[model samples]
Target: MVVVGHIFWLSDFGRFAVFGFYILSGYLMTYIMHTSYGYSSLGRKKFATNRFLRLYPAFWAAILCSIVITLFWGSSSNGFILPTNLAAIIGNTTMIFPHWMPSQIEPRLSPATWALTVELFFYVAIALGISKTLKRTYIWISLSVVFIVLSYVMNLYWHARYFSIPAGSLPFSLGALIFFLSKQKSVRYIPEAILASPIKLFFTSFCIAIVTSIAISQSLSFWLMEIIFYFCMAINFLLVLSLAKQNTFVNGLSTKLDKKIGDFSYPFYLLHYQAAAIASVISLGKVASLKENFSLISCMLTFLILFIMSLCVIKLIDKPVEKLRQTIKAK
Candidate 1:
């Protein structure tokens, strides 16, 4: 993921990965909610309670730290302290600021909180019974495509600039569809040879599309690029699911890493931007520009330090708040 971020700095293809993340988030969330704890089991109060516990404590701690940093370091050209207005503060604390306000006012702490805004919106939408209403597999798949197109249109017109939906939303929706499909008893499977062949073909085609898209267009139309991205992500997910079902070596490797990385992934992603920003400021982007042996050394050192700091924050601040939230929810 860090490599992708660095690539994003270098070329446009790197930007597509962000969309991949969003889509994956949507899919995983839907899959977990539906398969593990049936859609009906996740009522609004319970969903909200669980989500709040999972997200808010760490998020608020990060906000508080950002505030302290802003006070002492002062706002940089890109940085702004939290708005003093009660409305703005409340909106931000609740992760509703982006929905309620425009993008002119800078975010108080991490600028990347804007994505969190979209994520929060998604969570709220789910909790409000959007996911539960999908009684058929086709409905979920169709809605995913519809939303992806809608998100693309929103991007094209810039009407809803603040609610930046990541490209990953489509695949995530597809993931939900996959979960729904898996539960159906009459879907019927293809012959083993056919299934294997199509999965392979899908993967090859998906990779070719991604590489071709990157090679040909530096600034492709937003909608066009998103369509290609959705195709690639969907194929990728399908391939993974096939492998998992077949109990292949690749599936075993992926399952092991997915379990470990998935555990740390959220915290790692949440804290990485802040850590990177802090490192960039301190190093003045010197590490970003190194070459040859020094470049590798600098990059490793920077990543290590950032990871350690983030892990510390996760353990000390995030974990405690999580425990507190769990306690409250139990009560």
Candidate 2:
């Protein structure tokens, strides 16, 4: 959905997909920290180290890939800088490029990495609160709500992109809460009928309809669509919760596919904007000019090529990094 929505600009699937990703991250990270790693100082250090290993190598590879694509196929004005623009590249290397650089020059390489920056901050927050999370989950959940409210207000009034931190805090909090609640022996009231295939199908179809409505409203310039979008997004939280509980036929299929597709997902997400940029140049001779929103064939072709390249990266780069992380963990 993210890939297609982005390349074609047809729907707000990218936005929806990102929200889902954030929520899932929150759940998985909280689970790992609480269950796998202890809340002591050494545990926190190991947690932080593991997260760094997971994030940085893939991110740097994506940055390099984006730069190479931009240099070969992108125009200078397309917000990507070459090796000659050392400072811009340096800022990106630090992953704080958006913080210090001007708004125009920010996200010059691997534009999607803004999410990674927000995610890194979340990791720090989780690490700092590991002890508190061990003792009292409620306090962390409260703070998460406060952050979400503040982020929402800032997003409404402020133009800065980093203001997303607070908004993202809410979903992350929800994920943590979901994990905390799911483990409780007393909270076992989930109806088996709801988890049945038919009900799951209904919920999935409803969510799809909501996404389609959001896209239609956005395209038609409806003021109420934002309200609807937010409402539907909130509903999506429940959808995720319900789906997580049940292992359906579809879920089983997805699980099998994720083994192959999951590794490519990160690199694909990181490099896709640049892939689109490359596709534009290949098909239209200009990065900014989109032929009819975007040329479907061109974007798909570019995405396929990027996917193959990402496979090479996963094997050559990500696999070794994973091994190195395992070595560190063993130490």
Clashes of each: 3, 0
The lDDT per prediction is 0.54, 0.64
Model 2 regions lying over 4 Å from their true place: 74-78, 82-90, 97-105, 130-136, 147-155, 158-163, 185-223, 243-246, 249-256, 289-293
Q: Per-residue CA lDDT of candidate 1, range 1-331, in tens?
A: 4333431233344344444555555655666455443445434455567677787767776677667656755654334465778877876676565543333445546545666666776665555445554474356557666755775566555323223443334555555555554454433563445335444745564465657456546766755654565566655555544433442533336766755555565556555545544555465642222222234544565577556866776678667767776665454
* Residue 250 lDDT in candidate 1: 38
| Best-fitting candidate, scored by lDDT | 2
Could you give candidate 2's per-residue lDDT for residues 164-228 as a string of tens digits?
Answer: 66556766666666676555543356554544453464467457645665567457443355455
lDDT of 2: 0.64
